[model samples]
Target: MSGNDIDVYLEPLVDELKQLWDGVETYDANKGTTFKMRAALIWTISDFPRLKNLSGWNTYSGLACPTSKRRCIGEDADQDDSYWKKRSVFFELPYWKDHMLRHNLDVMHIEQNICDNVVFTILNDSVKSKDNLKASKDLQSMGIRPELWPDEGGKYPSAIFTMSNPQKNVFLKTLQNVVFPDGYSSNITRCVDIRKRKLYGLKSHDCHILMEQLLPILVKNALPSPVSTVIANLSSFFRELCGKAVNPMQLGGLSNHVMQILSRVNDQPVDVTNNIGKTMFPEIGKASRAVSHFGLTLMERDQAHRHVLVNCEAVVPFIDTFRTETKRKLWHQTRSPSKIDRVVHAEFSRWFKRKVPMDSTLHSKEMKLLACGPMQARCFRAYNINGYKFRTITKEDGLKTQNSGVYVSSNTSYASMRDNRVAVGSVPYYGNIVDIIELNYSCHFTVVLFKCIWVDTTTSRGIKQYHLDLTSVNFTRPTHTGDREEDEPYILASKAHLVYYVRGEVDQEWSVAVHVKPRDLYDMGGENEKVEAAAFSPQPGLNMSAAGDISDLQLTREDDIEDPIEDVSDNIDDVA
Candidate 1:
């Protein structure tokens, strides 16, 4: 037949075969069908030798050719059957490259299908080999069969066998050189080989076992470094198949797991400053900051300790003297600054007296005079007692007193007792009364006095007195005139006093006054109230009196005689 005639006749047949091949459904039972069909398609293209030489035609032929009738129809037609065979006769023999290329393509298709099925079985947990076999039977029942073989007869054409041999060699070589040479271990290499064998109809359970082992390796290897390095290397080696049909969801989950592992290993605070220029992923920065803060707080909590000490010196004095009843009363009462100030001053004064020294050079002459008992007494009478009495007299009485031998006026009576019984007409009985003068100074020195008073009233008649003596005290260190000078003047002064009649009041009323050096008498009402309260309700072991009262009374004639009658009347009236 003419080449054109043959082509014309074969064209419709080829078209029908192509349609059939395209329509042929894949079968699970017939594992080799797809590979066989692809092989037959390559054979059909080879039948048209002239077309095969065209540029880009080989690819087209493989894609478009019939899946059957690629060789001669007659069983015995060999040397003279076609021009292609004639050329093969002229050339030494048919080369394997052309045949192997098509065979490898077929083998590749089968291998891919096998891998897809295996992955499906692992991931889905529903599909199984038994299901695959059933599916393959269903396809066969529908008149669909593998296209490479013309019929179910045992013999395959010589050209087709030649094609398959080269195909096997090319496939195995490609696997060894391109896929396996990347240093995967022997076990993995054997696993992949089995997968290829399965594609060629060598069914074995080893492929499933290998796949099972491969899954953990993939998961382990794809994790973040450095622990996952081993697994990652293995996973990367399988990248060829992994790239083709990986489950994106599973991959994403794996990536997240890897990220979690990395986050734990590198538990440093994320540098938020680094994100200042990045506006696209604001959420990432925020999340990182939160994680960093959490880590920081956790670390701090993991490594913490504490120590405490309280100065109990001030409290030590009150420890034995404090009373539960007094504490309860004080707790119920609102706090007063006067009380607090007194306690604080007392504490500081005690500390200063015990720990600090005084300098005498800073004292004025007047202060020195006040420090001496006689001088202080003399000054006190001249300025306070005499002056107070003198001011109380009216102008008429004052003139009279200037002439009278005795200042018998009601207001001047108290003064007459202290000053020698001065007859106004005669020389002053106490002698020339030095000019009464008052001097004021800072906290250089002070004298506190106490006196008893008695009242003969029907409701009350008793003597009450309290004495608190404080001498010149310094709060800070004495200053020296020169750093090297051993004999530096004292920066403070000392004071003293006699209590003969420092305080006096008639009746049940008595009050003490604190006279600070250089002549000032501060009423003890405010200054001593806190001390009086504490002394009255002293704490446990320190309470001096069991009566619990700060003010006590005792009847005594000395108290009555010392109290001024008019003053006593006034005090009684005030107390009432």
Candidate 2:
């Protein structure tokens, strides 16, 4: 609507709102009673064009901003009375003139404008380029950047900010090939037209991801160092701004930092980077594979039950007591440490029920339930809980997107070979879930466990952070393969976080680990935390033997090496 058209449409709504504010009788549906009700219109939200129609402001002129008007750009900005279009219909309301806030600009569209301009100007689009001939003429009129002034032929000279044809191709192709985790954003690759050297049909969220995350990575060597650095800094600023939760105290500092980044880009001369590279991979789609299921055998059920018992908190006291009592008896004397551990796990459930009294003061309801032991577990292909969706490797095998990747931070004792002393610290382990099982405790409650294939996290063999935000792991060297009795593969499903590994550009052997945040949950902390990206290291040429089935592996002890028992409770936080 133009001119007073919006006012004509709003007249009836405004009159009704005024009547409601003065106290209109509202009916109580449940009580069948009528009482005086009052309501007030706080604010209206819209984009710049619609905002002008609603607020009777001239958004097309120099004094366009509704909040600051002539003072928006500077105190000396244009403030001519000719800029006035009309008085808003909202001002007709009694409280409208006195209202502190009456309109809010939508940020989604604002992001589009900023992102589109940056991309178009860099790509040097003739149609959408912000640094067109007119812009250069304006610069010439202002007597700044005389080198960028239009020539005698009225043709604008090429600016340093614009990308060369080769550079543009590399940037566009790299962006087109880059892959993101599932549900992170739409297919950004589809938005790029490499042949045309332009981006098209990008949604608001696509621009958001590109501005905050993908742009910095793709711009690395495509642009000059000064330009790329400015882009990186700007992206970082937006990343913090768009974080789940932001600290109000940091806003002043962020504002200053953004201004500095903006000024640096204009002042610094371009130093174009060379050796731009792009990595390409084929896209994957869902594949139909044969799925098989079978009931757990008697021995398999017992082992699964034992795995649950080890991680169960209420059963910890019983395990300690059983271990102590078994040490006193001569039964474990002839058995190896591995065999004894296996025997203890196998027999503990039967012994606990017979030896421990159900109604005893020490045995709480939880303890009693645990002592009775869990029945046979039910396997799942996929399970969702604790704000995460987890799938087994078997289930995710043929899928393009992975939901089976898992990572857990836990505390374990690290024995130093130099001093022969043990030091306990928290270590992050990366892996993929091989199986998911839900064990029932006689209908009282159930516990879900994730059997994972963990990468070797030892000092020489595990995760290595090569640079800031670059972490890599070798999937070939798995740690907990159930090869020895000490290898524990089961962990409480609640403790695992989601992460997906992407193959590195240079090192094909190592994959970059991208951490995925749980959706629909607010951090509620003082600041939004950042997880560094993990890249894989180059693998050594070593032929390792294949691992046998976990359940069929024999339980054996290593005579000299003593495996450290992890202090699980300390490392993990209890998530509700």
Candidate 3:
């Protein structure tokens, strides 16, 4: 409540306090039973006829006996009865009456209001006519075409839209190279076509940034000389108004009303409150002002941090988060995202059928099944390592195939002759498979297993070797022997992997599938780091000192150097 309304406003709070004070009076009569407001600022009390100003009233002695039992007189105030006994309820409230210092004049609030008032003065409809009139006169003086501007009394658009499209283009072209003063580089970023932007899109800070930081340089050439000078003066006024310290000389133009409002500030620098208006301008202390005055804490940083560190339970999927009940339509048919791989398969099938007819049969389901008959989908025992179950490893040629083994007891590396067997880490450990066993429990499905013996394929690895039965040979294609020496090696059992077949790569004949690992799918990626370390190792001739020395890389200017390619002359004799 600013003026006359102060009495009407304090009624509700006074009633609430009276009831609380009554309860206190019933309990403890000795204790002074009274209630009051915590924090408040009464402004422009002099304007209200019903109110009496508290500022003139002394802190201790001088008294302007207020409307309440509490006497809000000045300190060392003269006790003469000449002081006005106005019926003001502001001094009546013990809360506000007791604490006079808490009643303050907010400098930031006044500055922000002044800025908006200044902005509206230049932009409002009343002033726009005069601005357009002056612009027309200036344009005519410059010999610009009269057709660019509308006739007098026409509905006035903003100053930016007054020019024709070509004129606007010219203005924008020149705006590109507009330079700002030192320490003011923010305008450099806005050196684009701001012609299309509406004035309302700008915030209070944006307005200030344009006026103080950029417009001083921009208006020098872009606007007419008179308009430029006015803008410069306005920017200067704003700069002074929004400054940390107020200058009475800079504030002469402001009316007595504004000056009276400012008079509330009794000291050299006016003090403002923690209202939202003050925090927007940089000259005001922003959020720090609120914290200093009212102990207000902002949670913007806390909220952002909370969002970044959100738990899995708190995270909502994009589809779920923004789901709409309205049935939406699309140009193309929607497919299940979960079965996205199937779409790729269908697309390729259609492509093959249309683009290459003869290859269609080769790409058929029947043909693929014929080649990969034994490689049908089947789950195998996969040993878990590091909490990850890797189903396959890529074969040398990049195909997916199971890691099968044979008993190469003598031929395998790290084999003991006494045991006549190799450990699991050996490549030939699974080389021997003498028998096949099928077992089924009463309540279970068929379980197939290999009953095996050791093998000795010494020719493959310079160890020992032994051949297998015809049945066993077909069952396990142990190609690491005899004339098939160039065949793919038996993948080491140390890198034990389960595998799958490539459907598209299959042929008419039974194709032994080559394994390809999806390296990215594994929790632990492929052993690329280990391979890279060995590849770039220092050569034998170079010592550590030679490699590390800066002097080793000496640059020499070779004046004697000739072009490696001889430039042959046009004449055949000279070319030779």
Please report the candidate that would top TM-score against the real structure.
2
> Cα lDDT for residue 203, model 1?
35
Model 2 worst lDDT window (10 residues): 271-280
lDDT at residue 384 of model 2 (Cα atoms): 71
Q: List residue ranges in candidate 2 displaced over 4 A.
A: 1-16, 23-37, 47-86, 266-576
Whose TM-score is higher: candidate 1's or candidate 3's? Answer: 3
Residue by residue across 436-550, what tens digits does model 2's lDDT show?
7766776666766778888766554666776355679878777666544345666777677899999878867677787888877877755666667854434433334565679
> What is the Å distance of residue 550 in model 3 from its true position?
93
Off by over 4 Å in 3: 1-200, 247-576
- Candidates' lDDT values, in order? 0.28, 0.69, 0.35
Per-candidate TM-scores read 0.13, 0.41, 0.23
For residue 310, what is the lDDT in candidate 1? 8
TM-score, structure 1 vs. true: 0.13
Please give, for residues 454-499, the per-residue lDDT of candidate 1 as tens digits: 1211111122223333112111222211222121111100111212
- Candidate 3 per-residue lDDT, tens place, 30-91, comes to 76565432333444323122224333432222222242223444333554444543344544
- Model 2 C-alpha lDDT versus the unseen true structure: 0.69
